[model samples]
Target: MENISFQTAEVGDALQGSNPAHLYPDIFNQGSIHTYDAAMDQAKQMVLKFLNSQKKPFSGITPNKLAEQFKKIDFDNPLKEYEALFKEVDELYVQHATAFHLPQYIAHLNCPIVIPALAAEVLVSAINSSQDTYDQSAGGTLMERQLINWTAKQIGFSEEADGVFTGGGSQSNLMGLLLARDHFALHKYGHNIKYDGNPLVAHRFRVFVSDKAHFSNQKNASLLGLGEQGVIKVATDERFRMSVDALKDAIQAELELGNIPIAIVATAGTTDFGNIDPIENIAEIAERFGLWLHIDAAYGCGLLLTDKHKHLLNGLERAHSVTIDYHKSFFQPISSSAFIVRHKSLLEIIKHHADYLNPEEQDYEEYPAQINKSITQSTRRFDALKLWFTLRLMGRHKLGGYMDAIIETSKQTAGLIDSDPDFELLGDSDISILVFRYAPTHFSHDTLCDLNQYIKKQLFHAGEVLVASTKVNGKFYLKFTIFNPLTTMNDIRFMLNAIKTYGAGYLQ
Candidate 1:
């Protein structure tokens, strides 16, 4: 071999130089310790600056204008400098991003992420653990399992309970329904739908959900090869909760029609009203009919940690499976959610025996792999770390306090809307979400609906505030989802005033 300088190295030398032991001092090179530290420090400062500069919930930029600005960017060539790239990101992206931390951004289920969860995100990305198997993630798998057990205990499940982290409440709901479908098949007809395709009688399989339940139930039924018709929309009470009497009637009608009832999905926190169904009464109905009960507690799972409102989820323990979204009320980042089952053995329905991943018979006994239970994704992110870190640093009580504060804020907001002559409170809130409309004395139903819709559009375009809109009984309503613990009465008053101002202008 010929002696070659680094600048004019041969193929062999270049290959060796590409190794981790020999690399350039840049952020892209893992071997460069100095680059990593400097890059992280710069990123931290940029985040802090952005946070400090965001005084409003949004940038007020119109969609067309933002799209035109983004189209000007050239991706054909690299900027070659972190500073230049970061500057572009700040000006074009971060500046226009919605600020969920702001008190005025009460649009959806989004929450301000906790500091500990942010810290855990840094570590999680650095390690890049795919928590699907034990070999790929030794401690990560165990940590996730332990967290699932803890959550199960919090929900009053027995020691036989088990669960796995999912992408979100939607996926969790899918998994819950999937298990229900398979278990019903096995129990009723001694058939394994997972191995065999959809049974011939699958069309007769019915799943009951409240009319106000999340739309995922119908979607899940469709995805499970049970057509949309498989989902029977049971009537809801005045509070937007599933009516146990209506449920009994629906089940009886299904039985009369020679239909098989697979499961009954009870909503712990409905999307628009935040109303919780009568779980105790629903559980009784499920047991009497021998139907699987699945509770979608995505928004109300925070009550599990609250001392005062935990009773709201009184019959949650009787559920066959449950879906909980920590990101909604637990203050964790997006995608921190889990689908838990009352019986660990029920998870075997989705288990697979891949030799390379989780062998059916291991050489030695150890913790089971997560892939054995997860039905949605194979390459999963370590989302459990976010909740784990949050619990470790903030404790359950502090997290519950955040939930309590937001719930109280909803109550106060309802009171304010009722007291204000310009606004009409639609119904009471069971959680942090309240649905009401802008109703003036002179406006008709159609005019009030249009006014409320116009107000939401104006505020969104102006970017001063962000609220959601929904319709109840063919009338438009402005929704206030108060999940920010920092949101005070003053903030609520300001939001209300802005809505009034916009409504008045639209009318004029």
Candidate 2:
């Protein structure tokens, strides 16, 4: 046989020679790590400036304009391009960024991320590991698994639970619902539905959620092909929490109509009112009906950190699955969320086989074959690294303290609202959110709501603050969502005073 060149040599050369530390000795130290440290410091300064001055709400960049701009960019001379882009960005657009860290930013559920978590983000991104497979993300996968165990324990689930990081609360809810849908259907009908599609496991599958549940629950139901109408929105009580009696009645009604109750979604903390559904009561109902229980505790997942609020999610252990958002509750950056299942094997619903990605078979001794599980598996980012860093730097107790502080501050703000005769505190504060209206006189309920909505719009146009509006008892009212720890009672008071001051003319 003639001596022939093989591709293995080329692969080996590509792997070893492509290492920047070896190829670019001038920009890097021969062996000392300080050179890389200095480079990282420079990159950090440049990145921080970019972040501080980035545009808010994405600068309203149109797709066509963005496409044209992308085409004009060149990477051959990357450093020049980088400098020019940074200059343009810092000069033209930095002031428009949403001032999330500012004390007055009390409009939405967003809050400034913890400084430690923010720092970890840059370091984690620089490493860029994919978390889907073990080899690709050996330490990263282990970190995620450990974090999942901690969260599962926090929720009072058994040691057999498993979870995966998702894009956000929305994707977390989808994964939770997807597992619930598939698992319940398979247990009742058979596993064939996994491949064929939604067969007649029952005439129709129904999901029960309170009126105060986040819209994502219904949205997920629709996206899962369960139909938007499949979500049964049960009535809430005066405090906006799901009424157990109403839920029982709704479930019985579904049974009477010959519909299958697939899942009962109990929310730990609602988005609008911060109302927590009666988990213990709902758990009993779910157990009796043999329905899958899912808790959408995305916004309130931080409650797990506090002993006081932890009991609020008393029956979470009974849940088949749970959706929690670390971004909202843990003060991590955006896109930190998870879908947790009590039984680890239930994740198989998301598993699918592909010959190209994971060949059918491999030698068990030499190579371990990959199991295709997870809702999304291809080209995934290592989001879990930052989360692991967050948990390590700030233990569960400290994280819980942060949550307690927010809830306590909310209570104090409600007290301030109550002391003022001009303000009507919507309901007694139990969670971190308070929805109220500035009503000084004998205006009808409907009229008071209209006045509050008017004030909300006026505040937005003025660009001073952004408060939300929602209806209660068919009457409109302005809502103050206090997710930012930087927000104080004084800020809430100022916002109220502003509303009443600017809306004084509308009062008459």
Tens-digit per-residue lDDT, 143-220, candidate 1: 999999999999999999999999899999999899889999988889999899788999999999999999998898
Off by over 4 Å in 1: 1-30, 363-365
lDDT of 2 by residue, 1-508 (tens): 9998769978777766776465564453444366566656666776576566542323433346545645645668565444566554544445344556555566678866887787777757767777766667667767777788888988888888888777887887888778778888788877655687887643388999998888988788887788887899999998888899999999899889888898998888888888788889999999998988989898878888888778877888889989988888888888788888898788767776566655547342243222354675475777777777777888788878778878888989888888888888888646678888888876665577677777877776565676777777777777777777666777777777788887786755
Clashing pairs in 1: none
Which 10 residues in a row give candidate 2 its minimum summed lDDT?
A: 362-371
Return the lDDT, model 2, position 462.
61
Worst 10 residues of 1 by lDDT: 20-29
TM-score of 1: 0.95
- Overall lDDT per candidate, in order of appearance: 0.89, 0.76
CA RMSD for every model?
Answer: 4.3, 5.1
In model 2, how large is the Cα lDDT of residue 287?
A: 95
